[model samples]
Target: MSTVVETILSNHPQAKRDSLIPILQEVQEMEGFISREAIASIGKHLNLPTSKIYGVATFYNQFRFQNVGKYHVMVCRGTACHVKGSAKVLEAVKRELKIEPGTTSRDGLFSLEIVACMGACGLAPVISINGEFHAGVEPDKIKGILNAYRRKESENVK
Candidate 1:
């Protein structure tokens, strides 16, 4: 992991503090999620503190510290979806996954994200797992949806 970060840092030998986002973006792009070591390497390369680098990363929703799970669950909280019971749906996900938004499940099979919108208003109360939209989501159905992904993983493991 640090090796990848080191290679990325080598590209920005002349990087300034202003280059933080680009560097972080590159890290996230290549590594899927930034690790503490990546932030440390970036800080050393940019002459910034780890706190500053982490703060910057946290400031942007696009950044993630934990490695994303195989199924990245995005729950829509847009106005339309919200009115259609997205909040309950979101809670249901948290309950089922045993992890909240911006977090990956203990099994590393799922990560939850609450997004403002996904442009699927016609299908309000929607959620997208790995970019596959599941519209008209109901709280009771959250477990089945999650279990389906788990089953897929288990099958592949076999």
Candidate 2:
């Protein structure tokens, strides 16, 4: 078992069925997502079926099945933002990153998520990268934003 999987599983005993959600949350916190190996390990540890674990995890929107990339992008598609052309902005991001929502870019530098609302109605079209919000986003501005992140990544390696 992976260290994270083993470590978390160690904390929750087999008899504590109510601890499943907490265990899953901790695994996701440490590993970035709930991996398949983690599901299997958790199942074996809890004496529960893997399908049951998956069912519980799937019932909640908080669990992520795939690992998030270094820069997680969340695009607001709420009613207000949608009216202000967030769709175009979303398309722009998809083009710039060459990735769909709920997916990571090929190089693992970026991941995309579409959120229903950010409560930033004033900023009709907004995109957030790693919690940094970019307000009043326009399709034309997407390339520059992505390039800036790419530049930052390259600089980090240097």
Candidate 3:
């Protein structure tokens, strides 16, 4: 993990203020989430306080402080999606996974995120599991969708 962070910092020798977001994005991509160690290393590289780094990162919705679940579920709540009963769909997901938005399930199988838009309004009421779109989704369909993923993971475990 330190080596990965070191390599990322090395890429930005200057470590300008503007580089903070990019650095966080890259580190998150590599390590799944922002670690305290990464923040300290970034702070040292940028000559900024760790508080400042945390402040900046917390301001953005894109940065995640915790590791995501294996099945990262993003549910769209755009106008079209909402009009198509996405609220019900979202509720179904929460009920099925037993976790709210921005949180991973206790079993580490699912994480839920509410997005403003996914640009697939034509397929309103959409949810994506690890970027595999399940469009025109209804409340009843959520269980099957989740069960399919759970079954697939269980199969892999064996």
Instruction: Report the CA-based lDDT of candidate 3 relative to the real structure.
Output: 0.92
Return whichever of 2 and 3 wins on lDDT: 3
lDDT of 1 by residue, 55-81 (tens): 888888888888889899999999999
Better of 1 and 2 by TM-score: 1
Model 3, stretches more than 4 Å misplaced? none
Give model 3's clash tally. 0
lDDT-best of 1 and 2: 1
Total backbone collisions for each predicted model: 0, 0, 0
Best prediction by TM-score? 1
- Over 35-102, each residue of candidate 3 has an lDDT whose tens digit, in order, gives 89999999999998999999998898777777799999999999999999999999999999998787
lDDT of 2 by residue, 1-158 (tens): 79988988877755466789999999999998889999999888888899999999988867878788899999999999999999999999998889877778878899998899999999889999999999999999999998999999999999
TM-score of predicted structure 2? 0.80
* Of 1 and 3, the candidate ranking higher by lDDT: 3
